[model samples]
Target chain A: MREVFQQSLREVQERLVKIAELVEDAIENATSAFGNSDVAIAEKVIDDVEEIEALAAELDLHAIDILARQQPVASDLRLVVGALRMSASLERMADLAQHIAQLARYRYPESAIPKGLTKTFVRMAALDVEMAAKLVELLRTQELDVVAEIRDLDDDLDELHAKVFEKVLSDKLANNPTGVVDATLASRYHERFGDHAVSVAKQMQFFLSGSLD
Target chain B: MREVFQQSLREVQERLVKIAELVEDAIENATSAFGNSDVAIAEKVIDDVEEIEALAAELDLHAIDILARQQPVASDLRLVVGALRMSASLERMADLAQHIAQLARYRYPESAIPKGLTKTFVRMAALDVEMAAKLVELLRTQELDVVAEIRDLDDDLDELHAKVFEKVLSDKLANNPTGVVDATLASRYHERFGDHAVSVAKQMQFFLSGSLD
Candidate 1:
């Protein structure tokens, strides 16, 4: 029974890594789509989100099945519960990526990065992609250090989020109301993407350290 | 054993309803604060969010404890899992309320509702507060009717969300970049708050119907 529980745990971990990898791809494609006005890639990200959501739902069912059958106790039980949460976070990250891609799709041939804040957005998108990659790594390895790295990346993402606002509200873009709206939503999507990444990291932290603090 | 497990389920239900009531209050206070630029109420909402977070964590721990001790299966098990998801949604609703309140505080002495959009925001806030109230009732009664009501409210909220953007981008607010930024964020916050409420409703639906569909 113990060995069977351990095997189920491994399956949960593998599934989590699978979802994280898809989220990484989604964010990467979505950000690239946003940066270059790549409508095809944006559409691809948009379409792929449904698959991620389906997979997340499948993973959740699997987790619940494990709980009902194996009835894992102590740390084993926590591991299963944590998988449920990580799956939810990863699913949210995928949704945010879709939101970013939608921003690009909405703008069509027109660039979504606005006029003067291209660099800031590029940096923000990079941080998001980098964080998604690190999330994949963390879920695969459970390395505690990766948690700190994800948090630091989130700090950078937040600063860029604030910078996006600063530039949007400044006089330079005063006449560009559409730009202001697009930048606000896009920046928010990116920042939220980073936040969901951090949430996954924190769940991993709880699994590793046995406390969320 | 059966009685103890049933009692534990009751405990879970009570706790969820308790948390929902708190969430309803938070959104109510938050929207009021946003409308009136009442920094005091905004601060109150902000400060109370931590309590909601703490309660959510506590509820999560209690659900896990029940899982470990009772080893419930099937519907009973799903009930506990649903409780966990509901707690998460409620906690998120609290955070959105805090974000709305923070917007109010940030624009203290100045209404966060951009001129001409006051009625729209007020309507949106009303829907959020109403959804939250229905959430509390849904948790307390498990009445599936409330679920449909919540979805309808979310639809209205989404329309208002789009309307906010339309007005913000219109020529009337062309010069008010700050107003655009605030309206965008505040509208998003309120919309998300309604979304979370709908999420909780879905979880309850899952509990009652044995499927999330």
Candidate 2:
């Protein structure tokens, strides 16, 4: 019976890592679609989100099942609960990526990003994708060091997000108001993608350490 | 033992309602503060968020405790899990309200909203508060009618949010880029506040029906 419970726990962890990988791929493809106005890629990302959502729902039910059957105690209990939380964070992260893809889809043939701010957005996308990949690693390993790197990448995304706004708001830049709105909102999406990665890392920490801090 | 479990479950519901009320109040005050540039109100809202956070943390642990001890099955299990999800949603709702307050506090004495968009924002705030209040009632009653109202209100908010962007991007309206950014992001915040309320309502429905649809 103990072995059965342990196997279930391990399977839960494995599925979580798989979900993280799916989310990571979505972010990378979505950002690329955003930068290049690649409608095909953006459409694929949007279509793939359904699979991510289904996986998240499945993971959630599986975690709850573990809680019901194993009636896990102490650290084991925390791990199951943390699985639920991490599933939620990853689900929201995927939604953010979908939003980015939708923008790319909405403005097909014409990039949502303006010319002057394109480089900054590209950099933001790179940082966000890097963070998402790290999230996959952290989920697989539950290492604290990986969490720090993901947070640092989030900080970089925030800085690039701010720079996008700076260029749009700069007197020298000649961005129209519509383009400015698109850039601001898209930057926010990338920045929020990083934020969710950081949040998931924190959930992972809480699972391992059993500490809210 | 059953009575003890029942009492614990009721306490969790009460606390969840309390968090909802706090979040509702935060949205109301945050919006008013945003409109009037009232630093005192904004500051108070920001400070009050800490209490809301503490209450949410307490509720989560209480639910987890019920899970560990009672090991509730069937509907009881669903109730506890629902409590966890609702607590998380409400906590996030409060954070959104706090973000709105911070924007107001950051731009105190000088309103974050521009002149032409102020009325639209005020409407969005009114709708958001109404939705938050409905959420409180829905949490208490779990009635489907309240959920519909909340969804309708969210639709209203989404419309207003689009209008804010339209005006900012229009050739007729003259908005400074900074003010535009503020208005755009602030409106997004209010719209998202409505979205979270709708999500919680869905969670409530799921709890009662055991169906995700």
Best-fitting candidate, measured by lDDT? Answer: 1
Best by DockQ: 1
- Misplaced by over 4 Å in model 1 are none
Q: Give the TM-score of chain A in candidate 2.
A: 0.96
True-structure Cα RMSD, model 2: 1.6
lDDT of 2 by residue, A1-213 (tens): 999999989988998999999998999899899988999999999988899999989988998898888899888888888888888889899999999999989888888887778788878888888888898898888787787798888888888887887787886444366677788889888877888888889888788888756
lDDT value, candidate 2, whole model: 0.86
What are the TM-scores, per candidate, against the unseen true structure? Answer: 0.98, 0.96
Give the 10-residue window scoring lowest on summed lDDT in candidate 2 chain A: A171-180
**Pairs clashing within candidate 2:** none
Model 2 chain B worst lDDT window (10 residues): B171-180
> What are the TM values for chain B, all candidates?
0.98, 0.96
